[model samples]
Target: MTFSLRRMLYEDRYKLILAACQDIRRHREEVAKTVIASQLLDALDVDVPSDALLSHIVAESLLRRIDRNLLSGRNLYLQVEKRPQIDLFTLLQRAIPAVPQGYALANQYLVHAMRQSSTPTLLEIGIGKGLQVVALLRALARDPGKIERIRVIALDPNRTALTEGVAAIDEVRAELPFDIEIYPLVKLIEVCEDADYAHFEALAEGSLSINAAYTLHHTTGPDSDARTRLLRRLRALKPRVFTLVEPSSDHDTEHLTRRMHHCWQHFATVFDLVDRSDASPDEKFAIKEGFFGREVRDILGTSDAFRCERHETLESWLLRLKKSGFVPYPEIELDVDLPEYCRSSVSSGLVRLSYRSVPIIAVFAFAGEAG
Candidate 1:
């Protein structure tokens, strides 16, 4: 009897999703389609649907609203751990135009902060493959005389990524005119103790700048107070500047349906950009499936404790920053030219990267003061 009831619930969800897909197709207006999509996703979240049905909803219905090729052969349960490749990360960074643009904006802010001192120390959280650091090094190299030497403290949980990132920075250091030193730590920021932070603070010697790009969202959990406490600790550092780069979406909710809706909206723009990129079809598949598909799976398919991609909105981030004793830094402009598909806007303490009016990524710089 229990098995029969479970089967009935699954079948009902599958049928409801199918009907929602049809309704979405009939609706010509984007707002109407979005409403239907959100409602449908919310209802389906009550009882989890099958992987195949979820894939169909995404490939056939959700992505249709984005004006892109239908995602094919996608599984909701696809495991990202089995396929950890730096190549995929590289492809994602290159294929998405907003990515490099975000990196450039972040580098611009970091370089500006570095200029305040002759020997500045940078402790980058989630220093994945050191892509942003490498870019920052190149930017600093262009005007070498302003700074004498630079020290980079690279931190991330992935040992392989830490190894690759340090090596990349070292290679760039060889070409740059200034002396560069790298201290790579294989640990998550959430787990760092007072001693670890003391070591970090001592290394900076008062000239500290912090950068956490697309990786701080993972530090959001283990508990509710986690992000708050982490931010407080960062405030305690009293760094010269703290730069954060994150996707501007609200998937950090207990409501699975709302989470799914936000996830769909956010990744739709990302996947659409991937489709439009100059990358080959196979490369596109790899990115959408191997890179982003995993993130989608984690957001919708996993429990909150297990979900690492708990992205929040720009508003939530600002509130947290304020509560943690950080105000928006004065310079909030991206003087560098951006891609045609991407446009930037400055708010109180945030710089948003949007795709056709949808907020995609946000770069926030903060000083130790509540505004």
Candidate 2:
């Protein structure tokens, strides 16, 4: 056979092997285990079985490999190259009716923030897949003549994420009645960087308003100098308003406890609802053990890096803004209603879950000559 023919034959053989494996009784479970195991290996820079393995023994072995890889302390993203494309906006929209109370809280908070200025140029940090941006744009579409043109600059370090987000924004815009424009800023520009300051200043120099959301936590860590630097940079830009919405879990000594509780409560609920019971025992164990049990604990343990003092409480964040020479507005609270899968996990003891008896704070701060 010619080289091209041989290559085609090999490709066909691999596909046939995969198809054969799929015919097994526990095919779904097996596939899940293989995918997870392969991901773990990929993260570890270790070679794994690329050829199809049909035996249960092979599947069990792969699961063991995944457990070992996890024990080695690898990043989850490294292990799993492809994450499920979640339609976050659609999910949020569907969840609104079921959790109207929670939706009302978020809507009210967002409305109050928007009302702070007539033409706020919304800036979103960590614009993952552009879902939140799309939602914000949709909301803005309700009153196209609110005041003036809106500019959105989405910043992220990952080029792939930014590209995907931009594409998603374009896809969403095609379906919408409004013609809002979105700009993609791909540099991992820190709030503290001089270049960042210049870039932002140029964007906001003529714009009527400025705002940011859900992007502050990325700048936090044990390095107080870095944190201070970031704060100073943000203060310099002096955006008309800034809003931060983060996970409300405390990050002190109880970090692990909070994370475990959140994972068990939130993720476990999601798994029960979305995952199939017929999935391989290995796959089920992973969701229970690998993600909720291991991953959450690992992340919480690194609270110093992940925790934000400003995010700990809205009052504290508001106070910081005041101290920095910005007027603090009345803080609002927004609750993201958990999905049905997550709701199930909460009901079960799989995850520790709690709803703030009082309202959870989601504050906004205003700068410049506030109208």
Candidate 3:
């Protein structure tokens, strides 16, 4: 029966993972670390493996203090959903040496675009903590005298994160002179269709624009016709600019072996940053397990349509946008002289220019003559 075959395969993988853990005890080689990390990322993608599972994984895989310290936290899924611990991930993104430099990269684009328009309708997809956006609004407020007003439409499948984001924005409304109205809509962009966008026109007012920081990759596919459809809908809205912040790797593929390799390489760099950081042990573990670990699990454990963390590269992104009728801002080759801070970030290995050209976080102006 099919069930029997599935059970046999699962048992075989569990045995292999356990055996790999054993191998790590005897030899601390590059292969051993990769095996353990790959298996653990696999186990973590779907659900929290048992304490016994973690025990075996830790005993053989990590450094002494790190092994003991990593297990001291709650399950990866539960811990991140807590409103208070959300700050841990935020700190990792904005403060800790974050490679790809998502926090500041997106903020710069938003600030620059905001300055260009008197009343730009800023729409965001998957606004998690509302930290960077709030920072942006504050930066704009330094002008003080302009009666600035903009509408923010925060769309996310998780209403809880949206609620948290809205609450965070409300807390800062007093400090800024800008009048802003935030509308929270719950929808998965990948699955959403042309009909769903009927309301988008009404929501967008003034010089419409977008600020999507670390969220667009969740769309169901870099495959199927799904990605094309989604991009077309976005293009139809015709925002002044679409700012994207995403990882610069091929994590969205369905191939598990390739996925694990990409995951290991990407997270290794991230974990190194955590090790170098002044963040507390708990904070570091939270970023490692809750944020990065969840991304691995979501990418590997779920089918493409169901996965929460599907990501694509800049090349693929440009192609898809063009297919849907859009183009990268300025020209691909015409380099915008990034601020000295952005250039300096590359030395720390926190951010890098793609193709030795642009930052990992890029803003694409929709190439449409009208917004």
Candidate 4:
């Protein structure tokens, strides 16, 4: 079946199952398990609804081995080894447009910086699931003829993330035909402090540019000595452009009104678009309350380091580039449109009650000519 047709059918199935779930007299756990299975199927783009029966059987079998009561509680994670493949990748892709406007702007500036430079090599730090890397690859793939010998390097401490990303790339390799080369560097062989200029020199010897998405925050806290050590190393590498993207909201503030507003808007949209009338209000609420809000809050709340640093701000980061001997350029804006579901999340107080704030910016810098 074609993708469009499959999507329509899946939508109908989702609605049907949701309707079934609303009947409290029915086995709620069974309904929930079936619905979760269906969602996984939809995400995988599997054309066969019959396949979902197998998934349900698998879920039932797994639940039976764990505990009969557990199945009724709708704990699908215990039964599933992997996240629904569709949700995993789709979630990552969804983040692209949600990237704060600043990040996109920085990317444009980096592009301009690369055009002016004699050589352009791209590097991405913290290559999580390769969503951003894929985004970059997609762009390069579009103009394969224009780019000559593009070398993309991704660095991460997690072997699984890199491995999974490489696997994902391999899966799409045929569809995204590009000559651009991607190098996955899964190990940070040495700590930044212990490393000397020679270490950075070796890393940047060939790369003319570098970009990091949500990685720098993980590397060090704003006040930690590690931050300076990492910064010195970054400066030493002397890439033409160094860019970072992080949550734009202020971390110090527990109450972020604007972000809260956005979250509320997001939740409402999700309920309106994704929830079905057949689904019990409780089931729909659980999906929204237990799944979406909890997950986002956990992600955004874990780090104050990204937000605490002055450089986390787009303007401050640009200024730092100049201070670090890189000529600063006018800021560019990424302007990611938050999904309506995200907007709706605000009213739920997930941002204020859970995350404490909302992320809001992207920052970039360009190196000054080598002295």
Model 2: CA > 4 A from native: 1-120, 174-179, 189-192, 206-214, 225-229, 252-295, 300-319, 330-370
Model 3 lDDT tens row, 1-371: 01121222124444454454345445644454555454433233223332323333333334221243433442433433423435556667532433334556555555655666666667777777677678777877875333378678777788888788889889999987778888788876666666656666676654666766667776655555677677677777877666665666667776544554444444444554455566666666666666665565565444556776666665666677778876554422222344333342322112344322323443444433332
Q: How many residue pairs clash in each candidate?
A: 0, 8, 2, 35
Top candidate (TM-score): 1
Predictions: Cα RMSD each: 10.0, 15.5, 10.2, 13.6
Could you tell me the lDDT of residue 10 within candidate 2? 24
TM-score of 4: 0.49
In the predicted model 2, the residue pairs found to clash are 29-280, 264-351, 265-351, 269-341, 269-342, 269-345, 270-341, 270-342
All candidates in order of TM-score, best leading? 1, 3, 2, 4
Comparing 2 and 4 on TM-score, the stronger one: 2
Model 4 scores a C-alpha lDDT of 0.44
Best by lDDT: 1
* Whole-model lDDT per candidate: 0.71, 0.42, 0.56, 0.44
Give me the displacement of residue 363 in model 4, in angstroms. Answer: 3.8
Q: Estimate each model's TM-score.
A: 0.78, 0.52, 0.67, 0.49
Collision pairs in model 1:
none
lDDT of 1 by residue, 1-371 (tens): 01221232234434444444445445644543444344232222212323433443443444444433323343433432335755687788777766777778878878888877788899999888887899899988886547888999999899998998998898876778888888999999998999999998899988888998888887755667678778989988887788888888888987644555566567666766776778876666667766776677677546566778889998888888888888677664567456787788876657888875778888888875532
Query: Under the 3 Å rule for N, CA and C atoms, how many clashes does model 1 have?
Result: 0
- Between candidates 1 and 3, the one scoring higher on lDDT is 1
